[model samples]
Target: MMKQKEAALEFAKLASDWEWRLNNLYYITDKEGRVIKFQMNTAQRELFKNMHLRNIILKARQLGFTTFIMIFMLDACLFRKNTRCGVIAHNQDDAKRLFREKAKFAYDLLPDFLKQMVGAKVDRAGELVFSNGSSLTVGTSFRGGTFRYLHISEFAKICCKYPDRAQEIVTGAFEAVSKDNVIFIESTAEGRTGYFYQYCMDSLNKHRAGMKLTALDWKFHFFPWHMDKAYTLDDPIIVPQRVHDYFEDLALKVGSNFTSTQRRWYAKKEETLGEKIKQEYPSTPEEAFEQSIEGTFYQRQFEDLYRHRRITKVPHSPASCVHTIWDLGVNDSTAIWFVQLVGAQWQVIDYYENEGEGLAFYKDVLDKKKIDLGYTYGTHLGPHDLEVREFSTGKTRKEMAQGLGLFFEVAPKLPVMDGIEAVRGLLPSVMFDQERTADGVAKLQQYRKDWDDKHGVWKDRPCHDHTSHAADSFRYFAICAEWLRDGYSSVVTLPATHQQQIPTGAWT
Candidate 1:
């Protein structure tokens, strides 16, 4: 009787302590298929110690955060009454796997006494409801229920792949959770776009500023691959000079050293991952997003431009004529790029984009540029669709532009893919003013093939997102700039009729 009472007292103490309960009470199957007591690893422990109400984790591949979060949610549901926990994976397969491998598996292997104490009231496909009103649910997205704890796993992939689902999480699942409750949005870096990247950047900025996190503010947590003990190799290979230099530079930036074994492991891993290794096991946050996004049309072109330092200070010359290319949108955004052809080089001087503007507004913009910057305007290239007459006005955009004193020459119609190819060919000889065309340049870099999520393939057409306007305007420039090869004088501002008379040529 005395021994049983003593055991009961110890059990009660362990149950009361969350950390003790996490490690002592739970059992998880490891990657090697060994059922072991769930112990928090270094990265997990560090994250737990500094975790805030709202946390966004940007980490290297497989730090066991998904496992930790699932177990954490399960533990919370078991211990606390009326606790509603939710886990959101990037897809259905991941959601099922997380619930099966972590939550349900650990709960099944729990001590009989503890299991009896907190009996399962409801158990179904993707959820477990405790008798105490605490429950855990895992799915791709959740719509209605409020949650005390919410974990969004592989959010970067969701942002990159299933954008609509990502938005639903932001507007629905995220908003459903209370501000004071725990919410973990964790993922490896995908690219430099989407809400996940934006959130990481915002959190990073706040962290750098040393601002105390409020309930609304997300606390950023970064765990690099080198921090994990399992990342080291037994027989380390010779690290290449370039790889060694990168490691040294990254170490200096992040204030963390990489072991020879870890470096070797990373180098070997790069053999399979190639350009993706940096995204997967990044040494620094900036380095993670530095890689070109997959399926992007201008990825190679942009990479080459950066490599040769072509994107630099491209000052406009008074002697050369400044050309303009435009993508006109009535409801959407109007994008324009100012280019100057000097010998073989296409010097991209400036870019402008605006919404809900008229021909008068754009004409004023041109007049202002002429007066302020002393720009000697050359050929103004418009898309073939510029000749489409408006329903209300019965006037083509070209005619309206001419009336506004902004003369435009209609570019020859070509297939979208052909135009994309033209842009790729033209990009090699292009020099851009980094500061002046920063926004447009960023759009060009992001222009990519539309992903067919259902079929798991990339559609031939470009993704019609915010990047389209700039990309389309640049495509017009690439196609129409062939006319400039004939040496159309910039000093002579040709009349609208003269501009219309310009002959179209076969663009190679």
Candidate 2:
């Protein structure tokens, strides 16, 4: 009877204080292969509050952040009724370990009497269930079902591993989760490319500008190795000269004068990793995400445009003619980039995209661009692929469009790499409309080399994902614009009945 009273009092204490419950109840395997109590350090505690709900943390290695978040999510599943939480790892093996070795182990160590009160049971399907209806499941990916909580571990690695599927994964995961629930995505930097890098940059930019950032906007959490007190060595340590130079440069840039001990610890650690030390144990967020990944073709270009305010409001010019560039797809998405030549600048005034639509539908949209927006049509540019005859109509898309009076020119078919190079060269001369070309800008940002999982490296070939259509349209624009710049491209205006007509001049 006395033991039961004591158990009830302990359960009450655990139920009331989440922090205490976590530190006292949970256990994790330490580096020496012994289970230790799950107590969060000062840095971990600060990170917990910052990421209590929604976050994207770019952290140094071995900070136990992933472990701390796992326990927080487990707390939600145990204490709350009907709560459904998900933990997503980069792969199957990691997912299994996270669910079984971490989450399940914590639950299994709970007092037997306390487990009975919550009706805790081992779910055979890689989940923990309670009679009160709360549950936590772990998987490599989450789709279809709505979840109350979601934690994506090593998200940057996932982005590098599955570059093509990253967008789809993000879309599906966000849609499946309920509103106002915690969604934490934490990772160390893989490179200066990928979705994670972009996300952190955007968040950091917003936070720095003191903009209105909320739960809907992902909060940023960056943790350097020096923030952990344990990183300091007790004995005398000699720091390298390069480390001193780096800290000196960093102090000038970010106004951070780190202690000598931090430098010594980092220098000692760097000896083991050599050049990889900056990427692995960075002092600042910028240093962490500094190294550009190989095959990230447009990262520098994208950053330049963003930094220099190239992505801004480019209003429609009634005096100028609107030229539409297209990558037409039969069964897939067709993307159109509206470009208006303003003197020396290529003003990307708008963008439109659709799937499962005919040429007639697009024709209607182009007609509306003039009638509705009071802009005049200059010319429409399309890739050479539009000349391929269709099996159903026995006519090419360009031929069909001629009847609809939306004439298209066959852009000089160049190698894909050549087109990409042209786009890189042309980005400086181009200006994007923040509101109108927002989607197109994002497509440009995400366009990257596809990871060859079998070879464990990125291939030279592009990934045919959602971004492909839009990027292809932009590529077509670049190729045609190159012709214009080189004094080769001629805009031909064709009649409805396939009659020869005089070519038109450039839009002025």
Candidate 3:
């Protein structure tokens, strides 16, 4: 007795809630690549309910979170008119796969009656247009577009692989979406670094601080492997005694009701993968970030600094003389670290880095800062390279600085590794001004050794990138401190034709 139009309307009404379709109507490829009915697991359900306004998800592997997001976007497009939706994957291949295998497969599995109502075939560019003029496009780049709904899968990977592009996307993508639009950013943790990690932490902090979370700001949702019901095993006899004990301890920590079969699966999986299991199927967010991080040289030392509250708002005391440590670069970047040896500890009051400028510019900047902050200059410390005469000027950089008011005290040339070690020793007593030294702090934390991908090991040398200049400048500071402590002198002599104007004293 059901009319065709009435039946279609009823079905369309049911499709409004994605959870209903996921449980009863949707279809997808199962674990064995067999096409089967899609079912909402425990974690997915929790995630679905929690994804409101702006959502950022940090999820473990094989949880079908990406698929859920894709399907949810598609459902919105089907019923709504002019619903501009998009899904951007980390890489080109992932974008293609999501469009071809998942989105296309889900559409193909739709009932003939429903497919008739939602008219239109997919285009060549992985775009599916509905009868109501709504469209969903999957691609690697979605930087420009007035999108009503957008989901960025593997966002952390994007931040790691393409940092500049990620920055552009972060800056541009949100502004394109309307005020009430939805934007979901989901990814597994790459490391405890990058903007992605900062965004998640900021979201949590804002939520805790009782700020109203809106479409403008993201809300974090962490889904570990234990929350996914399918992660457990059906076989109970295979669990090892060691695995059982480990799971028992972990359960006590996480408050999970551990089953024998779950322990067996983890044991068998762990045999194939030792620590990688934790990285892939993490039990917690913290564990995920800690497990697979590339060996960062100063991470532990910096973390200790953070924990002991050394990295805080340290004001410049007018009573103490402020020292400047410089890494001078003509064509490359120039960096400087401002420090004051306060009583027993070193207070890093400020930091500055700039490129494509002359010595006069830096001098003017220094003069301005001194005037602005009421800082009495102690001495300027630069590398031994300052003594080298430039081809054009026919005078050393050290001579040029003397022409200005900055009398340079040359730091001893030490091996880069030795300087890094000195920095590790100095980190315990270093106090930084959080706002003034933000860039310097980040550079130090991220300064790391070059990774040898082919050899699967860290290279002996440090990675020289944008971070290197700041790190090298700080290294010079460490060298200067060490030399001064060991009774080194500041009276450095270079070639001088006439009477030199360079001043020398306690700065060494």
TM-score of each: 0.65, 0.61, 0.63
lDDT of 3 by residue, 360-390 (tens): 9999989999999988877688988998999
Of the two candidates 1 and 2, the one with more favorable lDDT, higher being better, is 1
TM-score of 1: 0.65
TM-score for candidate 2: 0.61
Best by lDDT: 1
lDDT of 1 by residue, 1-508 (tens): 9999999998887778888877787888877999999999999988878899999998999899988888889989888899999999888898888888889999899889888999788887799999999999999999897999999999988876666688889999999899889999999987665679879999999999999888999999989887789988779477667678888888788887888888889878876676667789877777677643777898889879878989889898998889999999889899999999787778999998888988798888988998998899988888888889989899988888888788888776767787888788789889998767866887888788886643445688988988899999998887666567566422222222233333333211
lDDT agreement of model 2 with the native: 0.77
Ranking by lDDT: 1, 3, 2
Which runs in model 3 stand beyond 4 Å of their true positions? 1-13, 16-18, 206-212, 233-246, 271-273, 292-296, 304-420, 426-508
lDDT of 1: 0.83
lDDT of 2 at 252: 91
Ranking by TM-score: 1, 3, 2
Candidate 1, which ten residues in sequence have the lowest lDDT sum?
A: 489-498
TM-score: model 3 vs. ground truth? 0.63
